[model samples]
Target: MKKLTALALGTVMAVSMTAGVSAATVESKDDLKNATIGVQLGTTGDIEASEYEKDGATVKRYSKGSEAIQALLAGQIDCVIIDSQPAQKFVENADGLKILDEPFVEEEYAICLKKGNDELLDKINGALEELKEDGTVDDIMNNYIGDNIGETPYESPEDVDRSNGTLIMATNAEFEPYEYREGDAIVGIDADIAQAICDKLGYELEIDDMEFDAILAAVQSGKADFGAAGMTVTEDRLESVDFTDTYANASQVIIVKAD
Candidate 1:
């Protein structure tokens, strides 16, 4: 009788443990299915979410990641998708948001130059290669991204064309540590990279700070040489402008205040 009681107790404990583990392992994909998701207009996250979930899941567009986050807080959307770095910053600063464990898509970020501006592109690509070889890219990324740097090394351009000198870069100087205003100077990762590329090619670097949605039009209208506001390469964007080989990879994340 004593042996049978001990065996029953052990069996119950084992079942309870298994049940707990099963509950923990299960994730709610249904929560995202057909749910209204928020994303920034003209962003990779927006493109990917639109493409990947073709079931007509309602997508709420915002002018910026912060706005999307605001919508999420206001219960306007079920989720907000944005780059991991900015997401981290947002999550650290905001409240009640959480990043989903699964990434909706993986993408590379790159500098976008005017289609015919081969000279400037070559110079920028060349500088990028040299930066990779000498670890300059790693150092700069570390300064801005810190310990969040991922596994891939800075990529070098395999081949480049060098025919045109005119280059106009468009960016939104609102995302800090990546692109933002330091007094009158537009400064951050994108700005620094643009400056380096111009210096390498010996071409004048013209920067236009504007709303994020206006970037693609600026590029399409030949009003800007390229768009490089931490731009992500997505198929939807590819239909509008050509992107260079990816230089960086990042994911969308959610930010909420710590519990």
Candidate 2:
């Protein structure tokens, strides 16, 4: 009877071990409960993925979303959680990567500025509303995303006045479509939108590219007038900075190895 008991216990232990291994295979969202998730530091994805840590998952953060994708490709991470648009850009440029059809979370993108800068916030929000009303905001976004990408580039009004001075924009340029480097200039949807806002408000736009985590600090320290790297408005972030009205809707998505 003792020998039979030992054999049954061994079988039970083997089954448990197999189940543990399968838990991290990551076929879908449920698997993330036990998988290692990669995310860009200080992003919505990082915040969202941290929730899974309580469920036995590990969250690994990188300075850039592309770096997280690289880690996923290297087998160092089970999957990546990132903004859907940047995930699409990464997946299209690389092989063996795919975004899950079901989004991880829905979010809105907005411009952030120093807290209590209500005067500037009101002006920016007003300008943004005007842009949206005239269809300029849609043109700016469609220029960088969707089938009309690169075909509907936004242009500044001819010889627009800039009497309000220059407003420096802090951003992490590694996020494609929204913001990224092209040649020597940082050109993307946010860049153009900032320019449009400046054009409306009479302030010349000056963008300062920096690490994602530093954007808020830069704006708070008065180093940049505003931060707009596809920034999301969260209650946590709202504690430190003020945000303009939301300009665009976005999603957090999962990037897994292509099947």
TM-scores, each model vs. reference: 0.74, 0.90
lDDT of 1 by residue, 1-259 (tens): 0111211222322232222111111123445555677788867777766753677567778786767666555555667777887676665555466766776566688877666667656767787786667775666576677775434333324443434455678998656556766557776677766665655565556779988889988888888878988888766677777776556777665333223
Give the per-residue lDDT of model 2 (tens digit) for 144-187.
88887778888899989998789999998888878877667888
Prediction 2 TM-score vs. true: 0.90
lDDT of candidates 1 onward, in order: 0.64, 0.85
Which predicted model would earn the best lDDT?
2
Error of 1 at 120 (Å): 2.9
Q: Give each prediction's root-mean-square deviation over alpha carbons.
A: 14.6, 12.1
lDDT of 2 at 158: 92
The residue ranges of model 2 lying beyond 4 angstroms of the native Cα positions read 1-23
